[model samples]
Target chain A: MKFIHTSDWHIGRQLHNQSLLEDQRHVLTQIVELAKSNEVDAVVIAGDIYDRSVPPANAVALLDEVVNQLVNELGIKVIMIAGNHDGHERLGFASRQMQQSGLYIIGPLTSHIEPIVLQGKQGGAAFYPLPYAEPATVRHLYDCAASTHEEAMIALLEAVTAHDSQGLPKVVIGHCFLDGGSESESERPLSIGGADKISPSLFKDFDYTALGHLHGPQYKGQEHTRYSGSILKYSFSEQKQKKSVTLVEFDADNKPQISLLPLTAMRDVRIVDGALDELLAAAENDANRDDYLMVRLSDKHAILDAMGKLRSVYPNVLHLERTGLMASNEQLGIRADHIKKGELEMFADFFSQVSGEPLTQAQQQMMVDTIDALHKSEDNQ
Target chain B: MKFIHTSDWHIGRQLHNQSLLEDQRHVLTQIVELAKSNEVDAVVIAGDIYDRSVPPANAVALLDEVVNQLVNELGIKVIMIAGNHDGHERLGFASRQMQQSGLYIIGPLTSHIEPIVLQGKQGGAAFYPLPYAEPATVRHLYDCAASTHEEAMIALLEAVTAHDSQGLPKVVIGHCFLDGGSESESERPLSIGGADKISPSLFKDFDYTALGHLHGPQYKGQEHTRYSGSILKYSFSEQKQKKSVTLVEFDADNKPQISLLPLTAMRDVRIVDGALDELLAAAENDANRDDYLMVRLSDKHAILDAMGKLRSVYPNVLHLERTGLMASNEQLGIRADHIKKGELEMFADFFSQVSGEPLTQAQQQMMVDTIDALHKSEDNQ
Candidate 1:
């Protein structure tokens, strides 16, 4: 059976105090379009549908509509689970009724050991939707059993296997930081206030593990266990990473074939560093200059006029920084411009009239000296 | 068509430091059960499905389950809209598809003035799922020359009437507060913060205004316009009020027959005040006394003995206060048990222990003498 796997939509979110609703919407529309075109059997959203446990109303509405479209319009069945960032009880509410419809939402905390059998035309498979379970909760829930985060997770899988009478292929959907998955700063911290760490080996029993929480389309290995990534880029750091949903095909034997569904953002993020003239020269011929640029110019002294100079070229530039360093002469093909006699003196004379904190004589000389150094560096290159 | 109307489910929420996930689950489940038993044609969640724009994954999962159940299991159609506390684009992601699956979710900023047509068992009605729109947005969306929240809302409805061809009865589900609906602190703040304060007359064009955002179940002078209130009270002050879902029966004229479906808390919350003895005297008789209790005792003379006295009866006593009068009045029964005594000794003992400065004997005597005089009045009362 072939199914599209997507996780971590994180709808209705904010970053840098600016709302990402528009951005999230832009991407989700694309995902739905992708799903429709792909013609997959069903969709499995592993976890983290929202950024926070208490999502805003609009976020809820967004999911409501999206699911409605998928189930009603597209005629797709969706199986979703709650994550650690979710309030388990809240997610499980009205689940019984929902399941009776084609929406298979698994939010059972204690019943994680049991699998929801997906009976289909091709064959059948059991889906175990494990929200988040803490070790303490497991011990209390399972008669004071020895419980660790990893152990509790394994214990639940064991339960799933125990109940696998139909012997169908099994899929486990979850939200966790595996023992080896790489994480960025934007991901939720799960150190448990310095208490526990989860091991990926705990999930060895399942034929496939569709993970959430991490916003990257990569894997601990190359197959079976993978992150579909968030619906949106979410942060400046993530601007360049390829975001994609995963499609997994599980055979009767539970072996799987996986493919990536690439998602591209409307804007590209590019960073550049150089001095005033050199930076301008490079950007002038640059193909993607209109991309959302994070230009980090290595111009000695502050560039108060930098924004204005760059804005005309890269109007959508989101950031500008002046880091002190020599421009890369080889990369820019910057030629040393000739300095006419007394040009510095003329410029200094003009500068004196612009404002009240006029540069001291020594400061004026420093400017000329800096220009000479720039010229000398260009000559060497 | 008789149906359950609920709104402002800020799932994945916290009230103060307390988690409301369990409460949300309990209440939402009750609403679904109520709808199933009553056999309503549809469930209208006016707006604010989540507390914040980014609901936690759990909230999303639960909502998916509940909504799925309402449609699939209970055979009830769910028609929802966006509210002020939402990011519309995200919530309405799959609205188009949801419509095909027998669920109608009106999300985001829409200029389509025509109300959604609902063919109920009792004939048909025009269901206008009006999302909350800002004045500027409304002007832009409908190209309506209107300003102010009320004007914008009215303009949208007028446009609805002008464009709608479904002439059966008409009902409008909206997120607005009338002049009379009391505001809960957890609600989006009033006009100053962009929360729309609109009169029910804007909805006079329709049979029923199923409102959201306000956390109280109420109806304005127009019997047809009702606020379903929030699914759960989100603050300490809301403890006294019962949270409920409104049931509305719409006729051919689109007028409503409204009733409140009372919701009970899984755990009871109570605040009690008294001296140690009076509190313990009542605790033994209180049925749910062992439930979560916030005890405030006005006891005099450091009641070091109080914790030991109360711990036996109350398992989760969060707050404890000690006032001088209460500690001194730990007598059995006979409230206002006037015979006051030993004020000077109590004052002398307390001051002697707490103060850093070595107070003189005369000073201590003066302080005690003052307290004794105050106790004299209590002795009489």
Candidate 2:
């Protein structure tokens, strides 16, 4: 059976307060198109269907549209699990009824992990979905002394494997921070430092393990075990990483062949560093104008309305940094004695630094008058 | 065709900082049982499925369980609409796929309201679900001059009737405030004052109109047009209102025979008023001990630890009021001369009134010392 393996959709996520709903819609539409063209039997979404437990209305709508297209329009089966970012109960709501139409949503882990078996021309493959659950819950549920995530995962896998002695060409889907997997800023830390990391060796028995939670498209230990990564670059730290969905095809023997298909964003996130004039010149090129950009200026002085000027040329510029000014100004730090000075003197110093010029005579007089009136009012009170 | 009509579920609602989830669960379970025993063809949930747009996880889970039982287990059809309290897009998510399994959920209103026709042993009945939508949206959607909800309803009904020239038996499900309908504190006002009030004349053509939005189960102008009310008492104002689900059975001619089946709450809300001693004597009977009680004490004197004392007899006392004290205190208002007095003098007056005794000489000295220390601290600042 051939299927599109994807996870970490993180719908309703925002980058620097900018909504990515349109971007999410664009990519999800492409996924639906890819599914239709490839004629995949099923789509496996491992976890993190939403960025938060209670997502905004638009995010919910986008998810509805995509699921409707894939399950109703394309007539393909969808198997999904709740990730750490999701509210397990909320995501799992109405899932039983929904599954009647070929949408399988598994929520919080239970002692009895049911496998959803899918039949193909050659044979049937049983899919074991292990949604993200806390170690304490697992320990209590299984009546075991699993104190860590790895221990909990191992116990769960052993339980499922023991029940499925017939094998039936099994595949496991999970959401975890595997040991040796790369990290990104947007991915919430699963545990303190490396304590929560689980080695990929535990899944050696499975033909293939599709994973989520780490927002980078790469392998942990083996070629068959992979993270499809987030569909979008969720943070500026992920600026250099390529985002993609993993496509896994099963052979006659149930062994898997995996491939990565890159996803093109509606607007790419780019960080450009140069002098103000150089950045403006670069923005003149139409190719750079539309990308969501964070520009760092290296000029040794504060530019007047730098963000406004940059936005005029680069319409999608989200952030602006005066690196050169900050670095130089760090040396000329405010002295404790300066804080003890009168309000007018402090205002004059701040005005000079920001405008790159001394305050005018009229401006200085206005500042003094304002300060005097304020003191007079305070005395009256 | 016969169906159980219910609305204003307001799941996840809280009363006096207490969770009513267990109460809601009990009532919903009873509803499911009623559906099975009655063997209804469909269950129509008019609107206000949740108390808030973004409900807590438990509310979502409860809704999921109830819907699963009604549609999957019992094989009954469910028709729901979005109310003002619900997030329309969120509630309507995956509705298209859900409809495949006989669960029809309508969200925002549109120009064309498609009817879901349910054919019974006798004849076919068309159900036109009119979800809650703003007047502006209806006006823009149909391009009509509808400034009020009544006008919008008229325009929408006209549009539906104009399209449905087949003359099939029809029932309209809606969530709106009709004129002359009694309301409670819990039901959110659809619009300011009388502007939102629509008349029962709009549904004169239909055999029956199942309504929601008002928390009282009553008819407006006609018996065929009615509100089923909420299943639970959401506020003290609704304490006297008897809650019920409206059972509508259609005959061979498709005319609805409506009856109200009273719903029993897990814990009843009660309001009791009398002197404190009289209330304690009444509580000695132990008949209404388990009921959630709001007590109003009529004694003119202040009672120390009244709540604590009352709770011993009435364990579920949620609120306590001293109406006699408030009435008498209004006449003995705060004097302007008291404002000029020292803090210690003001404290003495307050202490005397509450304790019904003057402060001891030692207590007065302590008050003086404390006030002196507070003044010194303020001077230091």
Candidate 3:
């Protein structure tokens, strides 16, 4: 059976909730489009549906619309598991009814899991859904019969496969970090007592495993076990790689064939190194010029017009850093007299230092006095 | 139709987790036993089965056993709604299946909802399950046509009661804080946006309103609305009242007769105020001595041996506060040295204020010196 394997749809996430919703909505729309065009039989989302246990109304609406498109419009079967970041019970709600609507939810850790079987042109496939598990959950699930998550999962799998009347091709979807998988900046840690690491060997039995919790897509020695990766570029560290989804096909015997489908965003991210105008010129004709850009510039003279100049072209610019490497070669002209002011008092001085700009000595003093006065009453407290 | 209407079953709750589960289990067992003996047709939990959105495994097991007993042993039906404390999706999991097994979950919310009708020996009854709603949820549920929670809830009820087809006695089960209900010590704050209270007029269409929040079985205004209160007494303030389950009998026209079923617990909390020895003497025949007890003693001199003296008889005296209200005779014998040392440094001075132990004069001086040194260091820094 052909299915799209994806996970870690952390809906309602905010980069500190700093108006990134416009960007988030854009990428999420693109993912829905991909699912529609791909005509995938099923879409398996492996957990982390919401960044928090209590999702905001907008986040809930977003999922409702997206799932509606997948199930009602695209006629694609959707199976979701609860991730470590999710409130399992919250995510697991209406799972029984959603199953009738072709949306299956697996949030609770179950010892006797019912494997959802998806039929394909080639034959049939069994979808085993495993939500992320903590030691306490494992202990309770297995009746204290299994001490750790690995033992409990392994035992559950053994019991499930034992009940498989005809050993059809089986695919397991999970939200766990494998021991050998690559991690990206956005992955949350699964703590054991206090440590956030779990062994990867727990998922060895399934024909193919689509894992989540790790933002970077990676393989765990066995080709079938892989990370599906996150949908969007969430951080500066993730700015380099082109994020993608995994598509898999099971042959007649249920043996699988896997491939990656790269996603090109409306705006890619690029970090550039050059002087202000030079960087702006280079950014103009580049393939990823319209992307969210961060630049580090070296300037000797005050570039009072730097941000004004750069933002005209790259409105999504996140940062601009000025280097002192060129100061020895050229007579750098900026207010060195502003340095004596304390750290919080020197906003204009610091901005000048980092932007190769000059703040008037009066402006610098004003910045200092304004900041100091703000703290004057605070000190009394 | 006769059923026990109990709400706010904040399972996994704790009086700091000290004797929390024991009280909860005891109260729940009593509630079920009352239901069994009363030959109730069903048990209706308005909301809040778990304290937090994510309930512990123990809470889940406890719920499972009680629900199983209500259905299998007593042949009673159970209907529930997702309370504000509940994660809607989690409460919704297996809801359909559970409904098929004589359990009705009224969590799936929509704007124009029909009242859930239940048929019993009384002929017929109508139920409207309204989960707690924030302004945003309320707006969304009403399709943005209504912005305020009150307006949205009113719209929802108008739609629900529109199908008052049989004119049967309609009961509304909701998890909301009505404006005038008695607030319990353990109830969580429902809103952070300045105000969170919702008016009780939203239930004018229903004959009996079974409500979940505000853990005291009381009414809002003169309305038929009633709060079943929380299962366990989660705070010391609720010690005097008997935690109970409410039984409602609906006649052919669905007009209701309600009775309060007392839920006796293994331990009853009692407060005794006097000198430690006197209070202990008064508690000698504690009919419920195995009960948890709090002892408040008032004395001018420090009773360094208080807990030691009281623990022998009232073993579960979890609290011993020295309120320091002295009688005239006790204050008559104060030595000059005792006055100089103040109450804390006298030989009879109470145990260390924090640890409840007798403090040596030398130890007291050292503590003062250390605090002084630390303050000096901080000031220097």
Model 2 stretches with alpha carbons more than 4 Å out: A120-124, A163-168, A326-381, B120-124, B163-168, B328-381
In angstroms, the error of model 3 at A206 is 4.4
- Top candidate, metric TM-score: 2
Candidate 2: the clashing residue pairs are none
Q: Fraction of native contacts in model 3? A: 0.00
lDDT of 3 by residue, A216-287 (tens): 767786888888877766655577776787888887766788888777666665666777768778766876
lDDT of 1 by residue, B54-125 (tens): 555666667877887788767788888888766565566545544546677666767675467766677666
TM-score of each: 0.58, 0.84, 0.68
Tell me the TM-score of model 1: 0.58
Stretch of 10 with least lDDT, candidate 3 chain A: A332-341
* A205-282: candidate 2 lDDT, tens digit per residue: 788898999898998778888899999998767899999888888887778878888899999987888998988877
Number of the candidate with higher DockQ, 2 or 3: 2
DockQ ranking from best candidate downward: 2, 1, 3
Cα lDDT listed for each candidate: 0.69, 0.83, 0.68
lDDT of 1 by residue, A133-240 (tens): 666667677655644566666666667667754667778888777767665435654432223456766666678888888887777743677788877666566766
TM-score of chain A of 2: 0.84
